[model samples]
Target chain A: MKSRIFVTLKNGVLDPQGKAIHHALEGLGFAGVSDVRAGRLIEIEHDENVSKADLEEMSRKLLANMVIENFEIESN
Target chain B: MRAAVIQFPGSNCDRDMAVALRDVMGADTSLVWHRESELSDGLDFIAIPGGFSYGDYLRSGAMAARSPVMQAVIAAAGRGVPVLGVCNGFQILTEAGLLPGALMRNAGIRFVCRKVRLKVENSQSIFTSHYDADEEITIPVAHHDGNFFADEATLDRIEGEGRVAFRYAEPVNGSARDIAGILNDAGNVLGMMPHPERMIEAMQGGSDGRRLFQGVMEGLIREIA
Candidate 1:
């Protein structure tokens, strides 16, 4: 089994990297780009016995800091 | 006072913290490795020093916070043992849930490294007793992720409870409310981005940082007495 965790800063949290990328895109003559928020994708390979609850625990404990970020898990 | 400095792999400031506690503050101090699940007994202070722990992988201080030694650290903190986390140590404390808020990337998108002025916010805590209230001091802050962030309610709560220990006198990083250091609700733990251990001696350009350790010693002595 495999899983993917998408970690992103919460909506109100300031994302400096995302802001810089947005600036660069605008400087490169791109139009209608309102905002950009950067995030991370973490891929994991695990045994089939790993339950969704276990994955959620992993995300809560380490994959995302609830203070400023949120994580979504997908499994296949 | 008896103290211990937790040393994670790549913790560059462990020696400096040990030196500050042992040589500068005249306390008996030891370096405890991260793999150890137990801490020595009768410790008055525990320091988590600054460094690229676990190479800042998966987020700064995330891995190190979950290290074996942290369980001991968390237990010690629960016992009201004084814990100080500097720079990456601050990140670790937040990740460990010992402190509120998280440190984010600098708003300027640059690594901030320099001596910056800080105002003592609340000098009544065990960590800030040596400094006068509202006193301005200069300390070196070197960090890529030093901007502190928290929900508005948390910010108001900490401020209302007088848990803010230090605030930047000038804009250095875009920290919320210019917070430079903060205390846990119990007032036994402190986490900050500045490296006070680096400014402990006059030869180190200033002795402002020495007062922090002195304050801790004073508080411990008061406890013993």
Candidate 2:
């Protein structure tokens, strides 16, 4: 079994890196760029017996800092 | 007072913290490696020093925060032990959930390294008791991901509870609300980007940081006495 965790900055939080990337794209003469936000995708391999609760626990404990980021888990 | 400094694989300031606690704070101190499970019994304080712990892999202090020794440190903190995390240590504290907020890349994406002026926001903490509230002190800050970030409500709660221990007197890093340092809800755990251990002596440019360690030592000594 495997799970993928998507960690992203919450809405209304300042994404400085994303902002820099947007600025760079504009500097390169690229148009139609409304916004850019950066985040991390972590893939984990776990046993089938692992429950969704367990994966959520992992996200809460380490993958995403609940203070500044939000995490979503997808398992297959 | 018995103090222990946790040394991760790449932690360069462990010795400096040990020296600050032992020599300046006059407390019996020991260096506990990242692999150690058990700290010395009856430890009064734990110092998590700066430097690139595990090369700051995954994120700043991410790998080091999961090391075996941190479990013991977290347990100790739950028992009311004073834990001070400086720079990389601050990142680890946040990663380990011992403190709130994440240290993002500097707002300008630069590694800021210099002496920064910080205002002691809360003089009543176990770590900041020696300083007057709002007093400005200069301390060296050397870090790449020292920009602190948290949601507005959490920030407000921390401020309302007086958990914000230090704030930058001037703009240094693009920290939210210019927060240079903060304490956990327990008030025993402090995570800050400034290197207080580096400023413990006049020969090191200033002794402004000496009072923090000394204050903790005195507070703990009084508690156990």
Candidate 3:
């Protein structure tokens, strides 16, 4: 089974990198961009025996820092 | 005093930390590698030095936090052993769940490297007992991801509990409450962005950082005695 995990900063947490990207876009004359939030995508290749709970555990334990980030797992 | 410096594969400050503890602080210190599952017994202190551990892969300090040696560190911390995490070590502690909050990228999106003024917020901690309360000191901070972030409730709780050990005297990083360093709930673990080990000697610009290690040594000696 293959899984994709999206990790992102939790709401109300400052996103400095995302803000920098937004500034760069404005400097390049791009308009109508309200905001940008940066995050990470982790792709995993796992055996069929790996259950969803295991994936969630992996995300919680290693892939995402629960302090300021949240993770969502998607299966394909 | 007997101390150990935990050295991850990419840790660049392990020697500096060892030197500060062994030579400056006059403690018998050893460098323990990350792969070592067991730490030497009877350790008075454990120093996790700053560096690009695991090349800052996944997230800053994420991979290094899960390394085998960290289990021993956590166990030791649970036993009330004093642990100091500096800069990247601070990040690792948070990732390892030894400390609260996460260090994010600098608000300016630049790697900040310079000596900045810090206020000793809680001199009562074993880590900051050498400094006077609210005393301003200069220390070097070098990190790209040193902006500390924690929820409002946690911030309130730590502050209410007087767990903040150090605060930035000026705007250096966009840390909440301008927190430069903080102690764990048990006050046995400290995670800070500033490098006190780097500022231990006068030749290194200032000796303000010396007191931190000395304070820990004295505190440990008192405990042992």
Candidate 2 Cα deviation (angstroms), residue B187: 2.0
- Cα lDDT tens digits for candidate 1, B1-225: 789999998799999999999976688999999999999879889999999999999899999999999999999999999999999999999999999999999999999999999999999999999999999999999999999999999999999999999999998879999999999999999999999999999999998999999899888998989
Backbone collisions counted per model = 0, 0, 0
lDDT of 3 by residue, A3-60 (tens): 9999998999999999999999999999999999999999999999998899999989
Better of 2 and 3 by TM-score: 3
Worst 10 residues of 2 chain A by lDDT: A60-69
Off by over 4 Å in 1: none
Model 3 docking grade: high
Clashing pairs in 2: none
lDDT of each: 0.95, 0.91, 0.94
Estimated TM-score for each candidate: 0.98, 0.93, 0.98
Question: Residue A62 error for model 1, in Å?
Answer: 0.7
In order, the first chain's TM-score in every candidate is 0.95, 0.92, 0.96
Residue A47 shift from truth in candidate 3, angstroms: 2.2
lDDT of 3 at B190: 99
